[model samples]
Target: MFRKEYTRIESSTQHSSVNEFVVINIPEEDVEPKQIILDPDDQPMWESAKIVAPTPNSAIIQLDVDDNFVINSTHLKMILENKFDGYLRADPHDHIREFLAICDMFKYGEMHSEVVKLLIFPFFLCDKAKTWFNELNEESIISWEQMRRAFINRFFPPSLFNRLLLEIRNFSQNICESLTEDWLRLKNMLQKCHGHSLAKGVIIQIF
Candidate 1:
């Protein structure tokens, strides 16, 4: 019965570029192991593939026609489930705030692993981030947490805090700037700098 079900799923999925079979009720020994398929649409590939080996949060897949590729587990899962649909797909550099908001949304949904995967995808990563990502040895990254930290460190280095602090300290109304525009700019920067804790005297001096 299990084999029959598995064969049916497999036959239906063969024509598709990616495939998955949900195993159920089969005894461990009797189950015909089907290699996991990493969707080719997620990344450009010469051919479709079947998982040859899995390590931690990634897998090595051999293509049907010929070739091999390594893909992260979270990415493979998302591809199989069609969860990558409707993503904002912005360039990370030009749309840092937008990408960060998307990341936060995913984190709130408890999909941290998927967040890292989405950020690192070539289509989503900015030119600078793509260069950095290409330089790293993919196998060395063992977890989503490490990937997230590396990405943040690359784009939002600790130096940003210092820059923000300097901006806030030196903020002043320019002679040619409208008072309303200046005040709004200062308020926004202060929010970024989290300046609510600054003394009232300092705030007054800036104003």
Candidate 2:
């Protein structure tokens, strides 16, 4: 280690000025300055730069199934084989309908149908849909009904509902469209917008 010593000396001039003199003392032996390295794992407890604690594996949806209720990988694979990425043209109502249909085909003995649907629902989403699901409050959705409502509310907003309602109200057969084709078109539109709640009599009257 090199030691530094400082001395103050006053100049004997008309205007006295104090000058600082520093003397550095070096050891006789040739020595290099020691370099200290800190192990990444041994970071100081108070250090802000310390490695962040590993994030807990939190899920958006909570499953209240029994301990024995194991998720079947085969079912998961089958459900995820077709992913919904929340595209602008993709119908969320149709996606939910298809998802429920797929869930209905599977039988899990004593497990409730809600449990089965809730467990398998997340696997069928990708890209933007998956991102939206993840951004939902942690474990906020625990039931199939709640999940369904949330999904519908997120994808099918009020503006879209109003627009679809207007379209359904103003539904008219085109000059070249047949009665069968026009009826099918109106049915398809209604299907696209779930919970239209328009009475059958009113729908018929509108047509």
Candidate 3:
């Protein structure tokens, strides 16, 4: 019942080669449905991807990698069917749930009290990070704070990080209101940190 309205099965055509590239759309407000091109290098991982939809009746999956049926589309409906089948096969609902659950976990970090134990630490995977870690005796320990800082300063726009913060906030104010007790606590924490910038200079590697 979670995210009943935010998930849908997808439909679309796909490349026929084992190593073909495939891209799919993501439907959500304030977020452009970007197509993710998956190459053969990621085919194995793609097999495990979960699908999600923006509405209860919508299917975000075009094909189910696990399905035994093989298809080569010759008509518009067939192509659409394959596309939809792929998305259905991906089972994005699971991913949506995972996304929402993570939001809940980070949102109510205070309630958990053992926040440090639950944090996804960051260890730099770059040259500058190598030198920085060398100065820190290569301990390789880091924190979410470090990840946020590196991402904001060295990587993509702060918006990327901010989007995560916003997701948590949206969950707290609009989504959390409908959630149960455990979810409610998580939402509270999300609301508190939704707009705050992360701290800096700590490295804790996440496995």
- Compare the candidates by TM-score and give the number of the best one: 2
Ranked candidates (TM-score, high to low):
2, 1, 3
List per-prediction Cα lDDT, in the order shown. 0.50, 0.72, 0.35
TM-score of 1: 0.42
> What shift in Å separates residue 26 of candidate 1 from its native position after superposition?
60
The lDDT of model 3 is: 0.35
Between candidates 1 and 3, which one is better according to TM-score?
A: 1
Cα lDDT of model 1 overall?
0.50
CA deviation > 4 Å runs, candidate 3:
1-152, 155-157, 172-185, 188-207
Give me candidate 2's TM-score against the actual structure.
0.67
Off by over 4 Å in 2: 1-49, 53-68
Instruction: Give per-model CA RMSD.
Output: 18.1, 11.7, 27.8
> For model 2, how does the per-residue alpha-carbon lDDT over 1-207 read when each residue is reduced to its tens digit?
543333322222122122322222324446543222223334345553657786534244555668777767777777888778997887888888788777767778755677787777878899999988877777787677888888888888999999999999998999999999999999998887778899999989988
**Clashes in predicted model 3:** 37
Q: Give the TM-score (vs. native) of candidate 3.
A: 0.17
